[model samples]
Target chain A: MTDLIERPSTEAVPGHGAPTHGDDDHAHGGDHEHHGPSGILKWLTSTDHKVIGINYTVTSIVMMVIGGAFAEVIRAQLVSPTNTLVTFQQYNQLFTMHGSVMIYLFVGPFAFAGLANYLVPLQVGAPDMAFPRLNALSYWLYLSGSITMLLGFFVTGGPAAFGWVGYAPLTSAINAPGAGPDLWIGALMLTGFSAIFSGVNLIATIFYLRAPGMTLFRMPIFTWNMLVTGILILLAFPVLTAGLVMLYCDRHFGTHIFEVQGGGVPLLWQHIFWFWGHPEVYILALPFFGMVTEVIPTFSRKPLFGYKGMVFATLTIAALSLGVWAHHMFTTGAVLLPFFSIMSLLIAVPTGIKIFNWIGTMWGGNLVFSTAMLMAIGFVVTFLIGGITGIYLASPPLDFFTHDTYFVIAHFHSVVMALTLGAFAGIYFWFPKITGKMLHEGWGKAQFWLLFIGTQVFTVPLYIVGLHGMPRRMAVYPNNPSWQNLNEWSSVGALMIGISTLLFVVNVIQAYRKPIPAGDNPWDASTLEWFTSSPPPHHNFVSLPPIRSERPVWDYNHPDAPALAHGHHETATPPAAPAEQEAHA
Target chain B: MKQESVILLLLGVFFGFIGVVYWGWGHEDGGGIMLLGAFLLGMLPGFYYLWWYRKSGGNRPEDRDDATVADGAGVVDAFPSTSIWPFVLGSGCFFIVLALTFGTWLLVPGVGLLLSALIGATAESRRGGNV
Candidate 1:
């Protein structure tokens, strides 16, 4: 069964995708090895995708550390029910900044600006993103936007403490008067444009820049997910910017957008926020879904069991996500409960399909259980729980009971933890590709276990407490035996997550110190990225591999790799040279 | 008939049907209209991609079902080597954000930096970026 893909054929033909550019079309195209500008200046001004990717990764790592530090401090304050390690205001600031930093600054940049930046171009066999300079601009804007949001801390009023959601009236001038909210608004606008532009750049790159035969179907699932994610970002982020603008006006210009006294409905804020907010959840998860999809198939030594299904699931998820934002607002009495609850429940169908798809990919195959695969499998186990809780919460009846409770906390955090696991999988899977150095497998597995265990430890207790009527975002809880005990337990889990992250950092250091040179295609994987050297050069591929299937590298290696040979119905050869065309004429 | 349209158009029809259902049954709600908006959002892009998927007629070689590794071979584009405009642009954006804090006075430098960055970028693009 493992040796089936070895049928043989040498065929060069254009099928349906690549547009012909007349006679001798392939003879003159823009192919240049633009490896220029070294040193800090190279980083500062470079339009290279690799450099921009590194910029995003390094910055996200820094933000993650800062964000994680905030979480640790929050946990310390929660260690005892009566603990006041921070003032109430300070705790709000800590949690607000932590959530903001992680969501807007860390996870997004890590996944898109970082991982997608590094991989998508290579995966699609493109030289670089379609708009190189715009891509660089996005990085700069994102970097500066990240700084702007953090600058809220230095302001006179302290950081924005109305929660990362920044629900209005609470954020209005009367209730919350501060430059910190203003700064948060400004940072969001900046980052919003950064995200919007990044979305545009990525979508264009995927559409326009594929190598000659890399058809839509043949493109890797990772690239397909990026394309879908790009569309979601393009559609969703602008609403956030619009919402932020309105919030700013309500604060500074004395507008009545969210001010109930001015005949403005404050619930408008929830509507606008969640409209983007729910889709934002998918934006966060989809790329990690792509990453785990890639990792599982590679380690399992199988083509993704339902490749097209995964792609369709991604699109279906994106579309359904847009309609389900009101699920977040079910208890507000402002939304159509039946419509939203149904949409929310409907979304789970596609999401559930993806779960089955991943499982099927690994079912009968030789599984490697590498750290990357471990994290992918970890994602399958963990996110399934998260998804189930989602169904429970989607019902308006249940949500009315659980609104703002730790159940809410457990539900979202479970999803976030699962995605975090997926992200770690991606980082480990591609670290070798990015740095050309293999992280120690032993340490990688250790990190995965700590995170996986820590996630369960931290979130499982929250579920129990949540079901038992514990609340979220609380600075102080009455010293009840049940709540305090569980809260103490969860803080220990948070510490474990912190330790796992530290282990990851140490793993990187050890890899660099010992220097395990990961050759091109370290996993014997089957994508175009592996076709080039680890840490691919200024130009990604030096030579061509006939991209007849999704697993081009595998096909290239095995020539007639089984049923793949029979599938090559491509009959139209590439456009002839002018001389050959004249001869034919 | 394209795969993207199948998924996207299905979404559009769902939203459209739900929008109509919502408006008919839940007339006083903003969500009914929003569902209509969702239908538009889904269909407009859905139709556009479907149209382009049809119109472009030629996809990148990778779009083909049977395309081989050789079919994808080509000279790649010359990616830009360096551009100072991003720094200029970022700085301009920074000033713009600062203006929100300090007052309208900061917009002077911000707008100026932005305009210059725009000019520099336009010039750089026109020069083919080798300069």
Candidate 2:
């Protein structure tokens, strides 16, 4: 690696001669890596981060559709008291697959593997990830894991139906006794290993590959969130892998780590699972939080408020999250209840700080209500509700009462809603940069409203019925008009949610079909990504803008902006050299 | 070495402090040991970055306040061309997974593909061509 870098393989463009950075010895960017095979072979064998990112993303979208299909079927079964849309056994499999596919394959990978793979190197001005081939391997491994999981349905006894948690002796060989649960375990182990490697790749990129003058603090908030997310993945995934290994041994190798008959403790499973599970929540969230941070500043036409505070707050939230896993186990009675509860409640402090930071960025600014911006606003509102409910659930008494009820379902769904909206905002915001084509703004808004309203319609009744003592994972129920009516409304909302995703599918197709080319910097965004060409060239940059502050692109464009005018650089302490000043001017 | 180490150190301290407290009070050695393991996990990486920072003398262009953008410009590493090693590795992992569903006899080919992929990838990286 050092030999290749020190070799200085500089190549020149034919006619486009721009000032290529400071030293003439430097290699030109964006002039290499156009050689290789084409078509499907290219996609499978390519080492390009952007191609791998698109692979991760497109595959995740398909998985989401699959998970959502499971959801729709499950909802149809629950829509009426006497409905037999699916057998109880089928319902078990449906919800099981739904939760597994959505959490593992869809949300977490969409951010950690998909968007991060595409954006990190571009935003950092690096030629590629620190380990390009390893990056390719991570994507393929992820695909294999996804395929293994989906193949469970075709196995002899149907897919694993012990819920996504795959809790305890219920998942042991004595009970499950088939290849389905074993396949699920194997699939999860593969995915978990894939995530661990991705963490190594991303963290190395951020640490070793920043452009000149882009200090750790000068890196954008999106990259910062990704950095923290990378660490959490490293810290959390290995434990999950360990637990899965123990369970796999119990099932296949006759080890009795989780079998009650062998004097194994079942609660140990909860301890191991939630240890990874709680941190997994932040793994899914922090990247979307990064998205919201990016979008609000761009559309509000202001800098992110408390940039340093947001960074520290992200760290604080992660550290607190690692200690709060027992909050999920308060109903189980085998945890240090007070310690975990207090730690769980303490996460609210940093999260609340983040909320205020978004609102502060939008306050008194020229806020543009674009589809992306509207989604950011929507994220703030919905995520706040999720946060409040989370606080309620942190208390042992409340959590004990709401442990398996729709109330807990409503709370988490609100959070998923917020992050999904945040992801939608990121997609619309960066679609231009990814494909060099503008998504239809009208259709984008149409989809956003459908999703937002659908979430409320679906979850509000869930909270109401949960308060009225409705439980979750109940495939059949006695006829009661009130619960029946509320569930019907929720079912309608589920249909609306399904329609919205389909609309998004249509919007993506139309955008590609009748292409409206979006010029670079369509939103006049502050981040480094906006400084590059749309659907950036293979190596991602021609020449990077001079980095003097967190908002390097903004500093380069608005030379007289107050932030730069007052000399607010995070990296350099000395006054700018004359040529440097002249160049920036 | 850098601010990241400091961040990791802070996490380690938080986990380590709670770990001692939990063991002192809770009396169940299992959970406390897990907390200690977490502390060690955070600290090991923290110390590694710190070590690299010191060994490199902490004079990286990124750390230089007055460094020009071009000082950091260049191809950071050689991005290799297309190869089938990742695909080979994937198939190896897939077969290992399948070995669980089918009989244990499949482990032979599964482990075989995995070892071949490892050796093949190492050779491919050191030399040129598919090997």
Candidate 3:
């Protein structure tokens, strides 16, 4: 059978045709070079994709801590309807910074830029990103942008109290007369540039850097999702960047782009922001969908039920995401209600297709309920609730009622929370692969349950209170004594989430303390990533098996029954088994 | 690739049909136009990839199963040995933003540093033989 597989060409593959460099050769060393930079300088100056990825991941985690702290402050303020924890102004800053930090700094960077950076190359069987230095530049810019945004805290009038959206009239020089909004504008512009660079790099890498036989159709679902995500960033972030420039000009040069009194429409800001904002939701989401896609197949021990369907569904979602932006403006009255409403509802079809495909993948398969799988399943349940409620808000009439209420808050949290859950799942699933050590499964499972319960406890009440007409971003509300109970419950849930996060930290610490080496393929997975060692070598794969299908390793392990056996052309002569190849060397 | 393109083309048509419903209902607003635009955009990749696949002999390295990792191994991507342009560029940007609040004096150095950094980064990559 091996000889049959090797009957094609004896010549080396065209793409992987370069001579192997000595391990110590810095000039052309493989990714797993024995001698590389060490210490802080190594992290700061390195262009290695893996190093940059770790930097991004660590930086985003720190930002999450900062953002979560702000959430706690907001929760504390709202615990008792009358402001006790913070003054009204402080409360405004708290919520505004919380939203901004979470959206811009934490989730977007963590998933698309950070996790994608680490795994995409390994999964695609590439050495590094197309532009490694630019990759480093993106991370630095992200870090600087995050710091610049947070610098607003030290300014005279607190950080951009007009909220994360920073609507024009409210954010005007006269309305928000401080350096804070300027800082917000500057921070956004910087981060926007960083995202654009990262997007371009990822798109280029995915398009040009696949291994010998990995084609567009054969790429992992996670890599495909990131590819779409990179496109979204390329298209969407620039609009926001333009908006930020306009906002800055309005604040300084007296430009009237969004100033209604100056003949600039305030709704212009809404149009611009949500144009980016709606797609931004998917920018944070599509990766989660991809992560879940990867997790579902592995744990269920089945080939992904509909690979082509999943890919098309992802593309469909991306294309329609642009059209559904105005659905967010349904209650604004200026938006064309019927048109936006229909588009909003229509976007759900692709999403629904994805959900069904996941269930289909799991149906009647041997399910391994790892912590990662548990979180993936949790995402399905929570995201479904979020999606169903979203349909309610898609209706103009319903939106008018629920607009600016806790119900909207609940709905947004449900979806973003689902994405966050999915990020955790990806982190857990790949932790061993990245670190060469398995996480404490018992603690990981405990963390999942806590977070799962905590999220429901935290946000579900926001729905109840929102339906009861409790407005969002309010420091205190009068004539709503009954709202206090739900608020307290929500705060408790927030605390639980915090605890769950701490447990995750504990799990990481414990895993690292007593490192048990995870071999090359601990999970017996199917992808190219598992074909290499845990924490893959500098140049990712030393040798790869025949890429017969999407599941290369699976094909290698089960040579008799390859996945998708149609049109199995022999591109190159099969090499010895990975272990055998190493032994021969 | 051809089959995947077909799937996307059909999905595009389905979305296009949804857009027609909106258009025929006399709802010719931005929302209706956007729906149509989305469906049209969705069909583009389908058309392009289909064309490329057919033109380029409908088969790619990914289509085969007999290649090994050694077949995939080669020169890992070229990376800069070391460079300071990122820091330079980042500092320039930081100062430029800071100059927004502090003083215009910072802008001159910021722009100067930015230009130098851009040139240096490009030159460094070329010099390092990575590009």
Candidate 4:
């Protein structure tokens, strides 16, 4: 193992030229295996971070559709006050599985692991992750876990129906008998391992693999977010892993950890789960914050406003997120309500600082409302609304009324929905760089509008009905008749979101079929990623510009007015000749 | 990095002050403990970064604006070419989890696969095999 760690193999310098190292028999010193491996095996055994990233993205999309299908069934059942669409058992399974798949499989993995895997290495100007083999292992573990979780649907008693939270006593063996919840527990444990592995890999890569000139302060905002996210995952995931193990032991080994009759405390599960759960919320959303941070600066054609403030705000949010987890347990009566309430409210301050920084970034710049920028701006608006609504819930007195109601549903859904928008914005902005193909702007805009308008239409009524005393997760509601209209309106909104998602699928397909090459730096952005080729080669870059500031390319473009000049270590080597400059350009 | 550390340290102090105020006001149960936790957590990264900044002479490559892509050209970073251990490890985990439902007997192979996968992933590159 030490020998493997110390192996002196040839490294490939891609993008500039072909294999220059003559010692190795393998093409590109085995680093460029993506060029060699073909067909399905390439995808399965390939250790390439890019391939694993693509695999994660595709799988998460499919999971999103499956989760969305479950959601549609939920909406269909709730279209009217009567329970005509499905029985209570089936409805319970639908909502539970929907929430589980969307949170664990789709949103969290897609944003943190999937997108981060692809972009982080590129953004940091590294050939691959610090641990490529471990990267592959993480992806495979995620797939295995996702598959295991989904397999519960085929079980005799159906999938776990104890809510996505999987609160205990309810999820204990005596109460929820079957392989369904067991599979859920097992799946969560596996995915928990996957997340921890990815977290370690990302933190290592970002910390150690940065280019020579890319300092900690100069790292991209997206990379900063990923860094903090990696820390949060490392800190928080173990609690969930422990919780899953305890639950598994309770279910299979009869340890009765949550069995109140057996001297167990059900609230223990809540404490453990929410300890990870609230951070998991930020885990899912912080990447989007990073995405918006990138998009706003690029389209606004300005360096990020309060760059130092944004970084500190992100770190602050991460730290505060840990202490505020009990906010979710505000109504449980077992929690210290005042402590949780104040912490929850205080966490909002750093988040508000971030929003202000974003708006300040766009305040006095050439703001271009491209599809990506529009989605990002949309994220800012919707996420702010979500954040504000959250503050209302932070008050324990207010939470008492809103707990388990559609109001609670409205708050989180708004945040996650905004996250979805930000994810879409990131996809649009980076699609050109990833695939070297630009999506059709008209179709992209159409899809965005449909989603934006539809999301509002869908969630606004939910808030209204919730305020009107409608409870969530109900298979059927009372024949209040007035609640029926709002529910139906929300159902219509769900349909629009569905249609818009399909349009997005079509847009991706259509764009891929007719490829238009997006030149390097199509957006002329300032980040290191823009300095490389669109659809960068195996090793990502041939040569990187001297990173003197956060935006190296910006400095390259404006040599006279460089962003920062102090502390730059100028090598004795002469500047590039005019001809060389032209060639590089 | 120093600037960020200072800002975070200040924020930590502010939150700590809030905790003290809350405690004084007799809302100390959840509020004071949580606020204090937040303050301590905040100070952790702040001090860590401050240490790093001092240790590294406060110089960062990202702080240089005169660099170009050509300056970055060199031997690319090393990466493993191909390996089957990740697959083995994933399958091992899947089976181990699956064994919870089917039978405990599958755990033997699961453990075997896991151990072997770990060995393979760690030692493959040593033999000049795929990375």
DockQ of 2: 0.47
How well does candidate 2 score on lDDT at residue A98? Answer: 95
CA lDDT of each prediction against the hidden true structure: 0.80, 0.82, 0.78, 0.79
Question: In candidate 3, how many Å is residue A567 off?
Answer: 14
Candidate 1 wrong stretches, greater than 4 Å: A1-35, A565-585, B1-15, B28-38, B45-60, B66-78, B129-131
lDDT, candidate 1, A1-585, per-residue tens: 000111112232323222222123232333333446679888888877888998998899899999999999998998888797999999999989999999999888888778999899889877677788888889988988898899988989888999999997889877777778778888888888888888888887887777656767777888888888887887689788988988888888878989988899888888788878998999999999999999998887767788878878988898788778888888778778888898899999999999998988787777777888899999989999999999999999999999998998888888988988999899888888888888887888899999999999999989988998978899888888999889888899999999999999999899899887776767767788887767876645544566767887766655544534333322222122223112212
Cα displacement (Å) at residue A14, model 3: 21
Per-residue lDDT of candidate 2, residues B1-131 (tens digit): 37878878889989899888777876756667777888997898899988988887866777666667657655466566566677778778888888888877888887888898889778877873211
Model 4 alpha-carbon miss at residue A399, Å = 0.4
DockQ of each: 0.39, 0.47, 0.26, 0.28
Candidate 2 interface RMSD to the true structure: 4.4
Docking class of 3: acceptable
Q: Report the Cα lDDT for candidate 2.
A: 0.82
Steric clashes per prediction:
26, 1, 14, 21
B10-115 in candidate 4: lDDT tens per residue?
Answer: 7677668766865676553544555576577658877997898899884453334444444444444446656778999998999999899768998998999999
For A470-541, candidate 4 gives per-residue lDDT tens digits of 998899999987899999999898899899899999988987897666666667677877766667666565
TM-score of each: 0.90, 0.93, 0.88, 0.87
List the candidate numbers ranked by lDDT, top first. 2, 1, 4, 3
Model 4 score (lDDT)? 0.79
Minimum summed lDDT over a 10-residue window in model 1 chain B is located at: B69-78
Regions more than 4 Å wrong, model 3: A1-34, A560-562, A565-585, B1-77
Q: lDDT, candidate 1, residue A100?
A: 94
